[model samples]
Target: MDVYIRSVNVGRPRPGIEPRGRDTAIDKRPVASVEVRDPGPKRGGLGSGVVEDDVVARRHHGGSRQAVYAVAREELDWWAAEVGRDLHDGVFGENLTTVGLDVDAAVVGERWRVGTALLEVSGPRIPCATFAAWMGERGWVRRFTERGRTGAYLSVVQPGRISRGDPVEVVSRPAGGLTVPEVFRGLTGDLDLARRVLDAGILDDRDHATLERKVARRTPTDH
Candidate 1:
């Protein structure tokens, strides 16, 4: 089955997308289109082969694990009402703005054949100060987190051309794999959910090490 790619966006060349004082590239805008490619081993990172895109905060974003970010048009519509304003595609700095897709509900390890590319759901986007500033909503970070509908990040499996209006195909989904939202709570110190994220066997060793410390601080809770 195919889904609609409402818009394909990339970071426009701006003073910066990071908060006023920081360095990052989170202010993405709808591009007429873009070329998507797999960076493969030993390249820049997630945002690597994805041409014309920006990821100034290299330490925090990009890599094979987070090659692309996706947010559903439906989620943006919900936020528009919440803020009492109109929100557009790419407002959340997403690489792909899709329609007719419950992106957050997608299971981790799910593969979507978008264009000629294959992308696997890796995790969720963590709300950050850059995001807050971009949205121009005070307490936006807290509000977005509370919504628990964070967008998903994907890793390029078999990269190819992607453009606006491309249809997305759900090639396969991992049975019982962690979901994008669960990954969000997991990284946010939700103990039981964090354990589930860990058991999903998706985290890189570096991520595992960071979560290990948090896992120690929180007592186990019933799932």
Candidate 2:
């Protein structure tokens, strides 16, 4: 499979999708192109790193560490089969829908050049309540978690424009970095895996502390 960006997506706020009637930008649609940049930090940042893309839930989404979200077309096809429906590009709220990339397997700190912009793999996207509601599938969060091919969140390195059909080149990868799925599984419930990811020192300070707490809180039965 040739690695490339299949689509670029942007979204606007829509009311009433999430519980509490909070606005959501999860229903992203394909666009011709997008300008990627760092959105600073979460909760007090400029919001979506992709220019003009809405990040309504600023407190929980979009930041320098999560400037862009990428989902593999192959994964979407697999999900379509599992859900018994056609899962289109951006259905999972991705900014870039990619082809031929095993996004879940991309190691944290791995950098890719797509079009003119440089993006670094930050981590795996964790399924949330809004995502669960959008999917409308029973036990969607748990099911998504169990499946664990949660795609990737990327941080912008060099601000530039990206478009559909742009080649995605792996420019660099850090040694000893954990793959997205490994970190996701660690943060989800596997104490051992969580510790391994933390020991790898790939996560930012905030994430590191968060994972450390999870490891400390491991139940007696968790291995």
Candidate 3:
């Protein structure tokens, strides 16, 4: 629908992007150019990255499923109004800030063509302690969770260079798919919606396994 990349952000993270916080690569700043790396299908799955974006928390971040983090610029504007402060593009910890795209509503299996690269929607960004600390707002995690506008995490399907102003078009989407917001809420106590993600079959194995484990843990025992 004519979505375009608003800003390409990467991070040169230091030990202390924030005092008393994890060395998250979330403090992304705008970059003039970004060379998206897909690693090809034989290598496994999509992984998008610019030259400057570094991964400090390797254990929890930087995999095929969570390759690139994206948030719609409109959502950033919404947070700006709600928090009574001006929000900038990179301030939300997004690697690629998009304009005119409903990121939260994007289906998990959906693919987008950006520049010469192709990216697939893996899932939504689940808020964590690092994200909470970055915001520095009281009840930030709860608020963000309730909002359910969690940004999408993308996998590079076809690796190539991508930069700001690149046109984004949906290449394909799963049939009767669940949206990003649905998956986010499902992770956060919504069993019905969470189960739907399994049915979609487009999510990464790691994420799908996580949900499978959770469901197993909650299953009813024989009476």
Candidate 4:
């Protein structure tokens, strides 16, 4: 089966569930098409590489490395079945709802060409408190982390227009690189997996340092 975009989604700020009451863009809706480009970097940089997609929580979301987010339609269907609800595209705040892709298996630094844009897989989507509140399910964060299908985040390498049904072509993959699920486990406190990912050396400097600190803090004997 060919990998393709099932929907192109964007969102506007909505009333948030967080304690601080900051607005959130978790309620995304599908659009016919979207223009994608690098948003530079987080904090003082342009937000949401998908033009017009709101990234109100700029402190933790949106940046050059996280220019776009894609989640597999199959995963959504699975979650919908699990929760006994109809989970629609973009409901999880993904910019792209994809079909025929095992997003969790994608290696970090893998490149995909969708429509005219080139995107490099940068990391996995880490579930946040906003996501948990949005789901409104008990122990949603722990449940999601355990499932480990957190879809991939991409950095735009070449700007272009993307639309529903656009084919997602894997342009390249890093040899022996860590997959999205592996990275997600590491990020979610799997010290052993994190140490292995660090050995792979696919993460950028910032992420590398972050994981290093996390692992070091948990493994005192490593020092």
The top-ranked prediction according to TM-score is 2
How many clashes in each structure? 2, 0, 0, 0
Poorly placed runs, candidate 1 (over 4 Å):
20-23, 40-49, 220-223
What would the per-residue lDDT of candidate 2 be over residues 18-79, giving only the tens digit for each residue? 87798999999999999999999897897889999999988778989889999999999998
Off by over 4 Å in 4: none
lDDT of 3 by residue, 155-180 (tens): 88778888899988988998878889
Those runs of model 2 whose alpha carbons end farther than 4 Å from true positions after fitting are: 219-223
lDDT of 2 at 116: 96
List TM-scores for all candidates, in order: 0.91, 0.95, 0.89, 0.95
**lDDT-based ranking, best first?**
2, 4, 1, 3
lDDT of 4 at 87: 94
lDDT of 4 by residue, 49-103 (tens): 9998989888788999889999999999999999999999998899999999998
